[model samples]
Target chain A: MAPQDDNVDAVEEAMVAEVEKKPIATIVIIIAMQTEALPLVNKFQLIEDHDSVFPKGVPWVRYHGTYKDLFINIIWPGKDAVLGVDSVGTVSASLVTYASIQALQPDLIINAGTAGGFKAKGANIGDVVMVSDVAFHDRRIPIPVFDQYGIGARRTFSTPKLVKELDLKVGKLSTGDSLDMSPQDEAAINANDATVKDMEGAAVAYVADLLSVPAIFIKAVTDIVDGDKPTAEEFLQNLVAVTAALDQAVTKAVDFISGKCLSEL
Target chain B: MAPQDDNVDAVEEAMVAEVEKKPIATIVIIIAMQTEALPLVNKFQLIEDHDSVFPKGVPWVRYHGTYKDLFINIIWPGKDAVLGVDSVGTVSASLVTYASIQALQPDLIINAGTAGGFKAKGANIGDVVMVSDVAFHDRRIPIPVFDQYGIGARRTFSTPKLVKELDLKVGKLSTGDSLDMSPQDEAAINANDATVKDMEGAAVAYVADLLSVPAIFIKAVTDIVDGDKPTAEEFLQNLVAVTAALDQAVTKAVDFISGKCLSEL
Candidate 1:
């Protein structure tokens, strides 16, 4: 048996309480960066890279946690939309990752990533924001304006209520088929009224809803959509603070869902 | 050049100006039937069974006009809703096909097909009906009751000037996603006040409008969605009358769109 597989099942088996008791997760934290810190976060078990299903060299790997009943799965979809990735390819990757997670049957879904702040006001780099809705744009069916083929105008599933209760400030987000940050495109999008841009949320939302799992997506505002103000380096300087804090939040979320770590894993 | 490739370019060339100068197609028929006759209605063309894009045997093939742009193009979907096939699949397929047609730049679009009469007034088989507006009864997306997905909804389109001149009787239409029907489903649909049920016209309209194309879709009443009434024999009885009349109308459309056949090579 795979050591990681055994660890997850053990936690799930040990945490059975009531009929509705979803498996108590040991603890799993998702990060946007690659660092030797994987062990530092999940207790130095064994973290190994695995083959990703998407052709784009995106990374996905399973981590064996130091605790007897916990393991973490990590996936990295390298940088924003302009890396020449199509929306279909992005959705396909997200679906495979979500399905892989479902096969493991985790109690909750957490997607950790960075987003471009299209905010006209207050939102700045390093603010942790919870996504309430995800709109997949650029899926042009070459037809009318109707959302018949899963356009942004079509709402998939509302963010789950339990997660919504966390009272995160809501924002409308859009995804382009590829990374294009020209002024004209940004102006047109601002005209459409979305405040953030990201690639993976809609795919995560689409498949997770189909599989009956609740997904909680958190993003660290990484880039401003061609704003007039700050220099790029000045903006990224705050990322370390955001990643460290976001990691703590992910840990709390994992522990709350998986009771085995009620005291310590 | 491959003969089929040569044929395609010839058809494309013919459609250029000669195709545009034909009299405005008086009526566009939208037909989606699971089992039906060949594409050309009254032309005494012998049909040699050929493999179609569909794996499960195409029941119909164009006797030269449709695929060659004799009338516009012929689309054969393997399924239909109401008394025929799956509603959602056909609806989705119709949307995609029509979108591609628009991409090809059509001057007109008509949905010609079989539909179940779900009106309480009780329609028998083979009656010709023109739908003014169509609404989709069962599409739900987190919206309040004040909002709907507009399946068979009334007056959904602007109903172009030429269409009004033809002066066909107006009827309401609603579509279900499956061929399976129940007396109660019939009753529910009847109560919603739609006069007929079919798979793809309104859906076609939804996308056609997005592409800014003029469209006219007409259907032949094939099944009564209400309580048990017409027999299958009675339905097939008018097949000749319906097909012949439809053939005439389609010819006029071809003539209008083709501006009289151009000199052939």
Candidate 2:
């Protein structure tokens, strides 16, 4: 065989060896709202994972499918975090995340959703962000003790090579319960130097950390929090566009993981 | 009749009129842990509110009873905000609080539970606190928009007279999703000037605010977040004592509200 053909055969052999040695298994994609989850679900053609039972009666649904030879489970915890009808915030997000972790035993977790970006940080609406670290911007434990508690900053694992390939913005993401913000909150966020804000990232990340499960957060910005338009309006108006971006990001993330596994061979 | 006797009769007549006019109807008490809630439930001899149903299968239970002529509902959402347990963080707390509001139609919501206090704020273990304002020390939304969102600082309705009567420490209570804290968290808490920290207060207060229902948070200090003892150890060691303090505070709060009804009359 020619030299180039021999190299190609060797690469193929290595790929098969890597798959046999360490194949990527289950991955759980946790999204707080159905709208935030739909794009990825449709892109992957995932079906509801009815066999994966949660502790019966928890208000959540899980979908699953094989993507790039890896099992992906998509979990929608509840409705939007917005006030009024069907609002699910941190509590539901955490519980559902914990439940999904237990039920699926995923090798990795990707919390894919939409967030409000900080324009000051060069993040614009529709920009996709990969959370490097998550902190509770709203969690105010008293000073001194807060540091001692060791929960001030929760960092997430990143596939550096994969991140480079995907060219995703890697930054801090802040999580809180409210969609509405105040000047004081803005100051806090700025102080933290977070690029994005969402309701469920911290909670979801916290659970994943506790379980020692590798997790990554991929968020598409639907609003510039400081933009002239109201946040609610911006969120609604850009939901479609942002979610589509999120869908693409999630796809890239899955491919990144799959490629990483093969490249390791 | 003598003048003294006539005055006494008039006073009695006014009391009767007050009862007829502004009777204490519904009071909801939202507690995080079952252990924290049991004291109040036992103290008041509360029975399960069979009529108050949540979305069938949500892991929560509500109890009700007539306390000092006011119908009281006690809701136990879940345990700590940690992983690998029956935990309900902000989401469950808010949802349960909202459900309780809808089902019980409470005129007042008292989020009664245990919290870690700031000793620098002169808070001692077993000291009962009445929340004047609730904010998310963990919820850091970025500036300009944060101010517009109106979620940075959520104030609770404080009846000065009632507070004075109950002799409770009225201060800011911070809410977050984690039980752990770190030095950095301490700085944030100090920045917010919060004296107490818990997982559920802000969520409950937020829902109550949205519904225009007056709410108060009554918390007993279980641990000084900065104390020498670990928070979990302190919490477990002081559980009974702190819960008792919470029980007493709740009773006083009930009496305070009931008295205000009578006083207005």
Query: Of the true interface contacts, what fraction does each candidate have?
Result: 0.00, 0.10
Lowest lDDT sum, 10 consecutive residues, model 2 chain B, at B79-88
lDDT of 1 by residue, A148-192 (tens): 333332243244442444444456566543333434335435644
Quality of model 2 by C-alpha lDDT: 0.72
Docking class of 1: incorrect
Q: Specify the CAPRI tier of model 2.
A: incorrect
For candidate 2, the chain B TM-score comes to: 0.84
Chain A TM-score for model 2, please? 0.84
| Model 2 agreement with the true structure over B89-142: per-residue lDDT tens digits | 576677677667766777778888889898888899899988888876654433
DockQ of each: 0.02, 0.07
Second chain only: TM-score per model? 0.59, 0.84
Model 1 chain B worst lDDT run, 10 consecutive residues = B55-64
